[model samples]
Target: MITLNHYLFVSGALFALGLAGVVVRRNIIIIFMCLEMMLSAANLALVGFSRFRVTDGLPDYAAQSLVFFTITVAAAEVAVGLAVIVALYRTRQSVEVDTITRMRG
Candidate 1:
C-alpha cells in the first residue's frame, strides 16, 4: 500500500532532479523549467501531506490553500520570466546564462 513516506520520497527525488538541472544547466529557459519542476514537486508534497495527515477529522484545507497560492505565484513568475527571457533573446540572440551576464542593459 502507498504511504505518506512514499509520496515524500518521490517528492524528494523530483526536487533533487530539479536542483540538479538548475545547477548543471546553462540555458536560461531550461533553468526556468527546472524552477517550475521544483515548484511542482513542492505542490505534490503538499497535496500528499494534506491527503494523508489527520487533522482532528477535518479536511486539510490549509495545505491545499498554500498550494493554490504557490501555483498562482508561480504562474505570475513564469509569465514575467518568459517575457524577460524573450527580451533578452531579442537583444542578445542567445539564452545562455554566461553570455547574459555581460549584458549592459
Candidate 2:
C-alpha cells in the first residue's frame, strides 16, 4: 500500500531533480520544463497529503482545487514565458541564458 511518506519522498525527489535541471541546464526551454516539473511535484505532494490525512476515502476537495489553480498558473506562465523565449530566439538566434547577458542595460 502507498503511504504518505512514500508519496512525500517521491515528490521531494522529483522536485530536487527539477531544481537541478533548472540550475545546471543552459537552455531556457529546458529550464522552463524543469520549473514545470517542480510545480507538478508540489501538486502531487499536496494531493497525497490531502488524501492520506482525511478520514473519508473521497479525498479533500481543497487540495484538488489548489492543484487546479496551480495548473492554471503554470499554463499562464508557460504561455507568457514561451512567448518571451520565442522573441529572444528570434533576436539572438539562440535560447541560451549566457547569450542574453549582453542585453542588460
The C-alpha lDDT values of all candidates are 0.94, 0.92
Runs in model 2 deviating more than 4 A are: 55-57, 103-105
Give every collision pair in model 1: none
TM-score of predicted structure 1: 0.92
Per-residue lDDT of model 2, residues 53-99, tens digit only: 67666778898899999999999999999998998888899988888
Q: For candidate 1, write residues 1-105 as lDDT tens digits.
A: 998999999999999999999999999999999999999999999999899876899669999999999999999999999999999999999999988767486
Cα misplacement distance, residue 11 of candidate 1 (Å)? 0.5
- RMSD for all candidates, in order, please: 1.3, 1.6
Residue-pair clashes, model 2: 0
Top candidate, metric lDDT:
1
